[model samples]
Target: MVVPVPPPPLLASHVAVRAAASAISHGRRVLLNGDHPPQVAALGRGDWVKLICGASFEDAADVRNLSLVYTLAGVDCIDCAADASVVGAVNEGIEVAASIVPTVQRPWLMISVNDDCRDLHFRKAEFDPDDCPLDCSKPCEKVCPADAISLKHSMVDGERTLSDPLRGKYEGGVITERCYGCGRCLPVCPYDRIRAVSYVRDPTMTAELLKRDDVDAIEIHTTGKGTDMFNTLWDNLSGSINNVKLVAVSLPDIGESTVDLMNTIYTIMEPHFKGYNLWQLDGRPMSGDIGRGATRETVSFAAHVASMSERPPGFYQLAGGTNSYTVDYLKKAGLFQSSNWNSGTATSEMASSHQALIGGIAYGGYARKIVGRVLRKIPEQFGRVHIEDHPDHLLEALQEAMSLVGPVKGYIPSHSKPFMKQVDRQ
Candidate 1:
């Protein structure tokens, strides 16, 4: 009698991929059955999850992969750079996800722009690798969460070897497209060679993007120092403001004046705010990948905002340093999807109507970090990696993404072992 043969690794992975895709589809179908658009209802119910592709991160391939993974995992929105190419990348990812899972709901495509050049989200780290000392320990590479820095020592001449002192040069520096201005590399560099270059998004270009049919939301990053810059930027985009389904303002906690600033910004937006609005309470911007502690600031910011009686109108959400611990923190603070909010506040109406006090969470660095680990496993030999093309890698990445997105969506994967392993590893 002939012995039975086991399936090859590729075929096994393909079966696993199908299983993962089915699980994701089931979760979305369960969460999205309400009368309201799934995103809006999620906002009302406080289970909304958004994937923030960094405001300055413009690597199209990476963005596309990230968008695909998060979209499959059932995020309500995808926030990405305002650049045309970046927006295209996000849509491409979403489209690919839809083709793979025919029933997947298309997430809102949101573009992120900044009013001030000083805003940390609108910058990139720069350094001249050739200037790096041959003997220097490259802490920048190790500390960078984005893997944006690359360095290699090369011989200076035909006679000199890489081992010869002062005979080689550092050939690679910050990969600008991959750098999202985290600034972790700045302080760690012994030579102080790294510099952050900041920029403001062009309003004309942004206005044109808003006119696109696929774009669904816009997030304006403000420093909260004053409203002059905010007013100016808003005026520039006023003509196209009505095109989006949602408008978000991302700002940091500025002590006692935080609520006052939010009200002022709301006042500025009231007239043209024809759609739903959200307040992104950014705690420690771009630090989510650090560890569990990074999520605290955002959670604290949410609690502070939730307690305010005079806060502005609009759904409230947490961002900046959000991670796996954010929901637990919110639950501990009595704010996760809790209809019982602090009484007699501007948000009381939402509470009485059974909407959640805190709308949801936006995972940026932490979200990317989890899935990126799986992405990095994809061989560089396969240039311009479309994640869906590699079923094995895609299955692994989907598992990693679901680990972060599942809890918020109340999704329990058919195979819990891989999901639990990812959560514990993180």
Candidate 2:
């Protein structure tokens, strides 16, 4: 039997398109007056916001949509996996956002690479569905935030008999492209069938991507065990490091030695690092979507690093478990845009600097989680969904995006007269 497909929501699309246009026009006014692409200024002002499209997430369509929505929302940067196609997808999204609002400043495009295969961000979950017991509950599917796992039971033959009614095998396992190696699936597997496969990006290819005109930055994910692997990767990236406007090192907080490790890494990059550098204090890794509590680790991590008198020279930012609550927590901790050092004792040089104590925050799983809700509304029959195609969905998605971005951007509320009237007229 053939299933009937739902028609596109054309009327909603028209109204939403108008609303989206109004919102974009109103929200992006901040980009118009910046002398140094607002992103850089944001870094200095401590309000920089970046969208991290997971280092292992290579779904081009989702990457493109996320890029478009976040760019319009006024994020300062978009970080994605360091693959040619992924980089192209990010640029495509930025280009589309620019098309919607001519004056919208293009956020810097940052690519993520790993110095070692052990980094969690550079892996994927794998398993054979056939090995899974038919009687066991599929907790792996339920626990997966990315919805990367899929399993269905099918009959061994064309028909099922009374004695073999439950003898079907499982089919259709992990969607590799959608999996970001969260590892939620591994622990949930009843049969212990799930395995994580990790791989490091080739430095040669990453170097080539850096040389691209559209590529604006690169992020190196390191285990923080030592500087040897990072130094090796830096050597491999050598001259290409100068091609970008910024370089970021993403690392987990490793206690008292974190500052020392950061200093060592900075030393390795300082000579050839001809651009702005950033330190991504990755707290709790990929747990942002879990809940409000997930944000605490990163905020606490930021508080720790911000208080350090001799951490390093690069701008500091928070990541790993950031979500909607991050900004509020930062504010509560007195780190949001505060120029004063946490210890109330800034070096003479720091006192004269214009930069904030903490540069900004990067939203990863949580950012994607909020926007992915809207993207999921598009019908499956629509195939590869370009959110812009369904303006109503785009507007909903944009509004959702704004809810997260507005706090950082200080966006004018959508309820303002002009834009509300546009929505009302629709």
Candidate 3:
């Protein structure tokens, strides 16, 4: 009997980096995959794009990480260190661009800032030296609710830089890499350097659906807060339809309403509404496209509501999912979208007519309506919290509050292990 030997499997590293003289084909262009030229920074990436090459830029009010290599369509991150020759209009290609930021596992989850902004300073850039009017009374500290901000002066590679409201200075200069892009302090600040990153042209996939002739699929971004708040609001508005028109939603730590609407929608709704949705997702329609607040039933129901109220439902899902991340533009929208029909603009609305109220908000309606439902449930688990309806200026004021006191709360080193036990306790 003769014996034969098999060759060992080759590792990727061991494989030769060879390329033929002929062009290698791709979705459109032929990539050499070897040497690449340097890239020049173009205009800042567009925010909140409505149409990306006639496709879907704002596919979801909040599109979590679909892991789409938009690079195929020439969608590249301004910060992406990838090789150039592979970007831009190589052929009659790339008519649009997606927000080239990284996606989160949960589209609706805001980067739980939890900051306390005070006397934060930019790293290496001395306000006194640059003649920055250098007003450090820093109102941002007084406003941040999450305690994720701070204000401090420190050294970075041996330079005095003021990084504030963060209670700590940048090691060198203002590195956006260190910023959560909350921009809570922008309006209050005297300078232009400190700013949060918001989507440029925040897409409205739902609105796009509204413009179409056929309404088939629909997505609903729900907070696992609960359904009671929504039900109450709906029930109380027994005869009013206008109150559900301009569904104004807000998330916990919005850059401001100036930011996209979707991000704020996730947080503004009472947590009760969010929690109920989550419970129902797990107990009831678990088989449908139900995911927490974004239950398949809820989405379908929202479509039903929309169809009855306005149009048919399409493929809509809650902005929050288990595969999205938050940072820069990619995860920005989830930081805003809300749980209910502030106006049923997206999948958050329902059909309810309130005779006395306007724009779906009525005096004592939301509170009184939702309060009974909360009381009926786990009385031990329920606690009453006062909520304020933010006027546009009020929203700006809160953003200013974030500005005056946001950094001290937001700039925590992701690697820091001090374990903010009290933060969790609260």
1 versus 3: better lDDT goes to: 1
Each model's Cα RMSD: 6.4, 5.9, 23.3
TM-score for candidate 2? 0.89
lDDT for model 1, please.
Answer: 0.83
User: What is the TM-score of each predicted model, taking all chains together?
Assistant: 0.90, 0.89, 0.20
Better of 1 and 2 by lDDT: 1
Give one digit per residue, the lDDT tens place, for model 3 in 333-416.
Answer: 322112223222223222231110011100011111122232223333423311111122212222222221112122222223
lDDT of 2 by residue, 1-426 (tens): 999654344455545544554565465433323345567667667878899999999999999999998887778999999989988899888877766665666889999999999999999999888788877678998899988888877766676433563588778899999999889888877788999999999999999999999999999999988989999999999978889988899999999999999889877888776677888999989999998899899999998987778877767889988888888888899988787434211111222355677878899998899889899999999999988787777877777777777777666332222332345534
Candidate 1 lDDT, 51-152, residue by residue in tens: 999999999999999999888788999999999999999998998777666667799999999999999999999989888998888999999999999988
Top candidate by TM-score: 1
Return the candidate ranking by lDDT, descending: 1, 2, 3
Each prediction's number of clashing residue pairs: 0, 0, 134
- What lDDT does the true structure give each of the candidates? 0.83, 0.81, 0.21
